[model samples]
Target chain A: EAGVTQFPSHSVIEKGQTVTLRCDPISGHDNLYWYRRVMGKEIKFLLHFVKESKQDESGMPNNRFLAERTGGTYSTLKVQPAELEDSGVYFCASSQGHWTGELFFGEGSRLTVL
Target chain B: GIQVEQSPPDLILQEGANSTLRCNFSDSVNNLQWFHQNPWGQLINLFYIPSGTKQNGRLSATTVATERYSLLYISSSQTTDSGVYFCAVGDSNAGKSTFGDGTTLTVKP
Candidate 1:
């Protein structure tokens, strides 16, 4: 089985620009999630998805960040008008919905907003 | 929301040495996982030990959900083991995983 894979391993953009990161989860996995970590900070949960439906998105930072999982296959996280504080590593993960308690994570996309 | 804390924020060991890392959570958790983040920022899953104990080669992990804590042990550590070890737990109530700050290990040859 293929592990979670992320696109654009690294992204650099100016403040106020927009960027979108993509994730292709393991096939047949129904639970997908997004997480991020700023420099020297613990990784923080961003959201969770059960199929194409968002199960929980309370951890999202603000309105500027948006996520979508179309057809419950892959996911995309978009950041509009990004800020300097948005510079961090964004990771996507997925797991089988059977409470197997295992989540496969992507390599992560490093975002640097100058 | 749960709080996950890892101890021994940083550790330095020589190759072949052994080390233990601890993780404490604020509440009950149904799932706990250990991950190794390489220098290049790739997270490699080490264990999905929610309870009991599991061993894989030179690495082992135990998560006592009853005590709300977990432990990771690395025996005969190698230079390839130099990286950050993270502990993440998923609360039964929230269904979301919270991660600790992680333990940075440096193994010198």
Candidate 2:
């Protein structure tokens, strides 16, 4: 079975620019999650989607960052007017259940805001 | 939010050596996972051991949910085992897993 897959393995953009990262979870997986890891920091959760509806978004850094899962299959994280601190690796994960299953992560999208 | 802490922050082991990595959390958790982030930046799940003990090949993990701590043991380490191991925990009430800084392991061949 295909695991979680992310697009634009690496992205480089100027400060204040916008970048969108995409993730396609495994088939039939209803639970999707987003996490970020800045240089020298631990991986932190960003948000979660159960099917097309957002389950939780308490981890979103600020108003400039937005995430959406349209049809419950894939997800997109967009950072508008990105700041220097936005440079890091963004990971997407999926599981069969909320807190009862193992999570599978993607290769991660590395964003470099110069 | 729950706090997950892993130690010792870093470790170096010989190919034939064995080592244990530890993780401590601040509160009760219904989910606990151990992951290894390889040099290529892929976070691979090793175990979803919320409690009890499990072994896979030369790697094993034990979680003491009552004590809010977990331990991962790597036996007969290999050069390919070099990577960052992370511990993540989540409570049913929060619905999100909190990760630790991770234990960076370097296995010398």
lDDT of each: 0.93, 0.93
The numbered model that scores best in DockQ is 2
Per-model fnat list: 0.65, 0.72
Off by over 4 Å in 2: none
DockQ of each: 0.71, 0.77
Q: What are the per-residue Cα lDDT tens digits for candidate 2 across B1-106?
A: 7899999999999899999999999999888999999999999999999999999999999999999999999999999999999999888887678899999999
Candidate 1 runs further than 4 Å off: none
